[model samples]
Target chain A: MSIDVLLQQIVNGLVVGSVYALVALGYTMVYGILQLINFAHGEIVMIGALAALFVTNALIAVGVPPALALVIAILAAMIICAIVGVSVERIAYRPLRTAPRLAPLITAIGVSIFLQQIAILVFGRNYFTFPEIIPKTPMQFGAVIVTPNEIVIFVTSLLLMAGLLFLVNKTKIGTAMRATAEDQKVAGLMGIDINKIIAFTFAIGSGLGAVAGVMVASNYGQAHYFMGFMLGLKAFTAAVMGGIGNLWGAMVGGLILGLVENVGLMFVRGDYKDIFAFVVLVLVLIFRPQGLIGEKVAERA
Target chain B: MSALLENKRNQIIAFVALGIFLLILPFLAGMIGQAWVRILNITLLYVMLALGLNVVVGVAGLLDLGYVAFYAVGAYTWALLASNHFDLSYPFWVLLPLGAFLAALAGLMLGAPVLKLRGDYLAIVTLGFGEIIRILMNNLDKVSLPGSDTVYNLTNGPRGVTGIDGLNFFGFKVRQGIEVFGHQVTGLQLYYFVFLAIAILSVWMVYNLQHSRLGRAWQALREDEIAAKAMGINVRNVKLAAFAFGALTGGLAGGLFAAMQGFVSPESFGLLESVMILAMVVLGGMGHIPGVILGAVLLAAMPEVIRYVADENVQQKVFGLVVIAPEVLRNLIFSLAMILIMLYRPRGLWPSPDRKADTGGSAK
Candidate 1:
């Protein structure tokens, strides 16, 4: 393979990996706190994409500048998706908090299916392309070419990750989240509102997922109802590969999965790109079930 | 004494009535168009698939998102053996057992590694395994078959294998479009074959498995893995058995499907098929054999029924607006039903009475 082609693939993988990381964080965080795999996380990403699409279209119709409209659209999408995330936890998950693990898991699947169906119903099944706000001109760096869209996706994803890390490590709410994840009962005894912390966690995770969705939709130039399904599965794999409750682990897992998938396509066909990531996940689980960086967080009795 | 006798009599009568209805279903469809019969056959195939999945997800307490992988393995095995591609000709009866065996082997291989994992981790790994198999099948065209570089096409790639021979029994061919009783009975015959397969398997295999010591062990594992393991259950062996059993059923369904369709493709066994089967298990009440059958029939027939209703333009528009317009609403409703059931009846509809009593504490 030529250097240029390899470089291009690497760049593509990075962009894709960054989005995977962003989505994986959602899974990791939710899993960390509630010990619940939020299957609906991917649907939240879809909702974000649709929400942004709607807002941008409305803004353009009302004669707003494309750039400003894009900004507003992204913001609106994030906020809306965050609220949906919090509401999902409160309504669907909370009641089943004391129920068996299977109940919540099944409910999460139901929520995911429900969200996808709703997206299809509202948007129709056809792919919706985000209006190009950023110029599509490719920048040449030696023999490697980079597009503005790719640059935007990478930078935005990193910023979001950094912000999340800071939120989790630096803020009081973050401490509460960590505490709740560690031991809900102890965290409650320490005067943390377990419910509120959980809601906040969902909001943060949802916001990140929304940003990833917008970035992905913009890069791909198309969004569809079932888009989140495979992406969700991939992100979940990323989360597990990196360690379920570990945030940075999810990031590493996502990047590794993306690179393996993209690079593996050199040997395997592109149709098997998805298969490569899944293979990595299975192998990783077999070898390191705790994940690459997963810490053992005891389940609350 | 009189009441007890009446109840026993009613139970036997109900069972006999159900049997009669099943026996006459093919004839009823033959009177109509064979399309309905074909659909019924597909529904039975789904029931088999759902029942197999139930063994893993419902009874063994393992969440497998890629149950369709076994179905693929079974179908492909039969397709390769029966098709002229490999020039290996096998009788349909022989290939059926071979398919199930291969599928079970695949299941055992997959199950062995992940026996130690639980919940979401197991789910994700299985999901990956499913995708890997699918990708391999898609790219099998490029991979040379054993001992042949003629671009040995095993799966026939995306176009899939066609011209698969139908099942023959003792010099009698069960071809589609044959006439019986002054009515054409090609598709109806296939339907009856599938129906009989499902009924026989459910009674002879699945039901028997449910009551066996092995079945109790699976349920124990599902209820509490640690407890079951502590109670002297060989968790790994039991779990592997569940996987193999599930795959066996899937393989049987796949073989029947190949015979019925006269073709098989990788596309037919995608992630969506897995989800649909899981939906059947969930919607019908997991762990309940009868409930799963009902779920499979309802979900399998749903799209076709929707298509039938939306056949007319005016009706299509109205249906689209009310029920189908928001694809999410139907999904949401379906999921909502699951959630509601989980909230109200976590044990699922028709949960084993013994299990119900055991989980009474957690049910609160």
Candidate 2:
């Protein structure tokens, strides 16, 4: 491909990667504390997109400005998905916390199916048009071109990532979270309400995922109930690529996965695009199971 | 009756009754509809699949989310070799052994890489591997060389390999129903017997394996890997054996499935199929033969039963109208059952007697 095409792919990859990073944070944070995969996390992203789609469309119909409507819809989606993420954990995961590994894993799969079915019951089984609320004007930089939506997605994702870092690093709750993740019993002894910290982690992570969901819907120009499964798998792969429990690892992993997948599309048919993330996942697990930025954590016996 | 059934007589009576029941199943099911016989055949096939997965995840304690990949391997092998896909139509006897062998080899290959990975990590890797296999099956239809005009067509892409040859013994085609003593035997009934026989063979084979010396090694390994190593068990070999054995069983089932269906496609071997099989194993009672069979039958027949029950009589009379389709309702019920069972009956619907005694039958 030509230089412009390569640059365009890179730009596309960065946009997609940011979304992956945003979702990966949810997985990494939950895994850091609970060591659970949260298979339904992707559905949270889907809910965010569909919820945003519905809210935005309704708001636009009622004479709300498109830009303002988008903002409100995203906030609403974040709140709704935060509730969903927390409730899933509370209902499906909490009871099985001390159960066998197989139990929790199976339940996670069940919860994922449950959410997807619920989504289908509420929203019909077809794709809903995600209106372009933002300007779609193309911005040309030398030989390369990028859309305004892409720039917004990338910038918003970066800002959210930065804000998350700030919250986890500079805030007291962040310190508590780190302590809880390090040793839940010890943190509990230290007067850190372990459950609350865990809930906060889910909330913050899911809210970020909501923004990512909106970005994904905006990028694709449509939203569907089943859209979350593949995207969730890819984001999970990204989380593993970076390092499961590390926030920075998830960010780097998502971008790398995104860039590689988009750039690799030049050499293969688009039908094979989903395979790239999975291939990367298997290779990474086989070669460097700790991931790029992950510390070697011992498996809990 | 209870006093009459004593000792060896009880075993003999049970065996004879089971045999008679199986013999009459096609006819009994045919009384309702031939479609029910087909469903029963599919259920028996799932019994084999669940029994195979039981060896891996249930007995060996290795979570393989890609177990269906082996089934795909066997199905595709049969599809390619026994179908007119490439104009090579191999006999069922040759295809069966070959499919099982290839699937076993794939299991070994898959086992080698993730031998050190534990639990969820192994699960994710296997899941990825399964997806890779599926994507390859979906996209390998037309593979063009870079900067070359030559293209290779394999797997026929997503449309799948169709019109596969059915099972034929010598000159007898199983698909072509036969008559005996002026009685008509439908092809579906023939397939039912074939599946039932295969299921019985598999269950017997797996039952023997579960009690073998190697089986003890697997159980030891599952309980405690380090302790098993200390006990002089060859952990690596035992794990590989589980993988290979399970894959072999899955392959056998897959080949039979392809022959019966006369078609094989990528859609049939998705992750959902793997999860479904795992559910059967878990729901029945992991590492328990009879329980696994029960689970397989219940889950495999569930959707069809739902479809039958949700017909116009129930949909219009009971619910007033069909708000949700039977397909969606099946999934909803299936998912809800999974969550609820894992929550309350974590040991499954029927826990093994030994495990029950060991844990005092506690849910935990």
**Best-performing candidate as measured by TM-score:** 2
Highest lDDT: which candidate? 2
User: Where is model 1 more than 4 Å wrong at Cα?
Assistant: A2-8, A185-191, A297-301, B1-6, B30-32, B84-89, B144-150, B177-184, B306-344, B357-364
CAPRI verdict (incorrect, acceptable, medium, high) for model 1 = medium
Q: Give the Å error, residue A179, model 2.
A: 3.0
lDDT per residue for candidate 2 within B239-307, as digits (tens), equals: 999999999999988899899999998999998899889888887888888888988988898778877
Query: Which candidate tops DockQ?
Result: 1
lDDT score, candidate 2: 0.87
Model 2 Cα lDDT, one tens digit per residue, A108-210: 8898898898999988799999999787788899987888898989999999999999999999999999999998889999999988898889888888888
**For model 1, how does the per-residue alpha-carbon lDDT over B179-221 read when each residue is reduced to its tens digit?**
6688666745655765676656664688889889999999888
DockQ for every model, please.
0.52, 0.45
Q: Please give the distance, in angstroms, between residue B118's alpha carbon in candidate 2 and its true position after superposition.
A: 1.8
TM-score per prediction, in order, is: 0.90, 0.94
Q: What clash pairs does model 2 have? A: none
